[model samples]
Target: MRNLASLLLLFLVLLAAGPLQAAPRRDFANQYQPRRTVEVDTRREGDSLRVYLRFPNRIAQRRRVPLRVMGWIDFDARRPLWQDTVRGAARRLRPDGDVDRLSFALPISRLVSGHALSVAFGDAEDAMGGDAAWLRLTPENLNRSFIFIDSLSRPLMRRYVRAREVFGVDAYAPGQTLNAYRYPLSSLAAAPPMATSNTLGQQPRTLGLQDSARFNADQLLRLPAGLYLLRLGNRGPSQGLLVEENRFPQLTSADELIAPLIYVSTSEERQKLFDAPDPKKAVDYFWLGVASDDQDKARQLIRQFYGRVVVANTIFSAHKAGWLTDRGMLYQILGAPETVYRSGNEERWVYRGYQSLNTIFVFRAKPSIFAPDNYELVRRPEHEFLWYAAVELWRKGLIAQPGR
Candidate 1:
């Protein structure tokens, strides 16, 4: 009986060792069968090409997969082909090397009147284990190409060319009777004309109101270059309108110009202004109606805010205006900091002990240094407003210091 019991225990040990010995071999096979997937999309500003490679959640005990991307451009055709290589343990294993996203910009000069754009992708050495998809460019598919308009003088044109059957086309000589596309305002349920009295008295004034009126393409084509505010109506649900100055140079063959105007709503506009890098003017505009009651106070506040912005500029001008820069804007709203630290590319701010508030601000200086100076702020997370809330609580004496 004792001998039988010992043999049984030995058998269990052998069973466990068998699978352990085979695990490494399976891992080796997976590493070699790397799988990949990719997608390509183009917007007016530029093209976004994404490649996603999936691998086993665990690779040699590490959570990350290594991927390398290589690409080439067909200058005349304005096309690009990108490829990827899966290396290291990932190459030896058949993890889910499925998807990777890689983005590249095509120069606007490369796009010509008759030329078509195309993109392709595959694994290193043209490996057959992954999937590849290409986006073809044609006059009817203008949206698939990136058309950048960096100047206010440039005409605002649609980035995409729909199916040729969807719209008609006409061509013209440059600087000679520029061709125009017409879109019926009634067809666009989103961009309704505005009727509000709110107008920015500035030279390039901004108008914001609500109204429901049909706008003709001629009106859109004739609008001078500058920001124009439009409101669809004040009665029912209001539709927002944003009319910028310019024409889209790439979609010249198009005769119909209609876009969804999804991002240009009034609320979106206000949110954009609030998140703007230098939002003082926007804030002033928000309170414009009340400025008449206490002009002195309003002026004082504006000066104080501007002063903060100047100080922020002096201290935070790594790449942009002090008030427009991340750290400068945070400092402006949060007032002064209780503690601050600088480390390589990051600036950290700490504000402690105010009611239920504790906060930290981190700014990346190097990246901002390379960004455009006139860039606007578009988003501010909830945590960023904590300092303002803390100040309010501190003033209300809801929070007490540890020592006191």
Candidate 2:
């Protein structure tokens, strides 16, 4: 049995370290992962690249929370071509509550062949194992040609992509050509949207909404150079550049990312991790056992699988961390859905597995006192087999086929 003495010592250490460096709070109310509180959007322009960061009330209300970030652009074989750290306050970003915006522009030369911009939170790395995220930099396009439009409603996309009441991609959608010009990206306006005609080249759903057509505000943001996740504010995240997340899958701490395992971990595995002096080691060993003793296989599986976990936390956070949300849990465990059907009040995720068999998970939009986009999973006993099989694949280092 684990003794109280060791537990007490660990608690005291965590307590003394204070909020920035404290252990993850169990409340799910007060403490949350950085991804849950902060939003990062990177923009590129020739040798000059701009990064825009958004901080919601969760972070804005807490003045002492680290509101600083450091970035390194890797262009040279030996060292970074440039690096910078940015600091700001929530009040300067906005007058009140529309999500504070912070922007940083850097001079990045097009001469570099392979490039990537790495960014990290300035403090609290030890507490969360990481408060960092990065994206690849592309310079071939000097001007902002691609526009990222998010939270576009379905009624509007019907006019552009002709999705016809289904969540699917229309490669030929002229929404961008027809709509992008109406909604321009603004760090200030906060609500009015502007996008160009070519913006909706493919994706059709909420993002394809006719909001731009309705509001009729034509402020244009020269397309930010690289892929970005666009937020039109107070809605589900939509693809930018039809973008995929770029998460640096480095193994930092198992304790930092233990939520995904709770759905699958055995009682004994849970107990062992709780008692182990180094919880990360215990989690790693459990994965090793799942990998049938192959260390490399364990690392790869952990990286890809947990990469989904990190992505969920980054995108779906509501009242609590995204992973705790019904949609986020399924996302972390099952990977991306084969197709995500979105509307104003609900989101339906469809997953097709081995043999083309399909399972569906529905989340009804339920706004809470804390967050508006919160959702509740429509669960059933039939999910047991699906859940068991999904966990089995993960246990054997396999992944489920979800979607783009």
Candidate 3:
């Protein structure tokens, strides 16, 4: 069971790096369908880390499986120091996929900046499809002054100017009747939106959960997805709060389909595609050229190669498309590493590459207000040499080459 937990942790780590739709797709709706996943939100409240697990109500709404999470806090030494668990019995939730949250504050007195915290949901021993994620404790994460949205809640995110950055919504409007404050903070008990505005684009309405009964900006739960500000005592925008859905992964697209070439393309080769009249065809030509003159071989290569792109899309997606990420690039170019080392706050992938040479890549787990699972690649000069050699093999229709 311990071995299984370790493997489960490793799988979740890699899965977190990419998008969650790693399975073979038969329809486009599957991509947009609510994902069966979990998101971790942390804030510093006094001496403990306020941890919130956010998910869609539909996740386990129909199943009898109990939802549970096991977690711990780690200090700067990069090791676990304490562990705790929270479980919720199966229950009904309204409006399928309407957001819901399970929150528990854990002790973090020993946790300073650079420490980490993690949580795993569901039973690992029973082969249940549990999910896990971790966060690196930092002031930016703990210090964000946010209004709690319970009785009206989900993942607690900050109010910002743009929804694109943090997986939330944008401003419904800019100018308002109320004056904006400068660095102001406020709280909400239960309130509704003010009267409708004369604004053309953003009409005033009661924005509830999923915008069902949206009230005013003061109401945390019924807040509409758009641009607004942190108002003081129900005044104007002091600081902008862009709100939108933060936890869901983005669906794949055509542009993302070709983004993986960053790792394989040389500076000159990549420019050719950009300079071409049709960049899409240019991408196809490059792959066909790499396949040497065989259409069948090119088809196989594209299928097998981009298939990895799909998986990478499902696995590495965070702030950007998965293929654009460092881990995604490596996975696309090198396949899965032979071994992966993971802790509460770090990851190391060891790949046995060509000639059985071990090419080791180290990634540091960097938690952000928007993404807790984001990891940064620690680049080394040796990586360039390794990357180019692998590209050369692919250029000759060898790497990730499908069998006849």
Top TM-score hit: 3
Pick by TM-score: 1 or 3, better one? 3
1 versus 3: better lDDT goes to:
3
TM-score of each: 0.25, 0.40, 0.52
Candidate 2 lDDT score relative to the true structure: 0.46
Model 2 lDDT per residue over 175-211, tens place:
3322221222111110001222353244322222223
Q: Give residue 390's error in model 1 in angstroms.
A: 7.7
The sequence of per-residue lDDT tens digits that candidate 3 reaches over residues 137-212 is: 6655565323333333444432332223423222224232222222211111111011122322352233222222
Give one digit per residue, the lDDT tens place, for model 1 in 50-98. Answer: 2222222232234343343433332121123544444453434333233
For lDDT, candidate 2 versus 3, the one ahead is: 3
lDDT at position 178, candidate 2: 22
Better model by TM-score, 1 or 2?
2
- Which candidate, 1 or 2, would have the higher lDDT against the true structure? 2
260: Cα error in model 2, Å: 2.5
Q: Return model 1's CA RMSD, one decimal.
A: 20.1
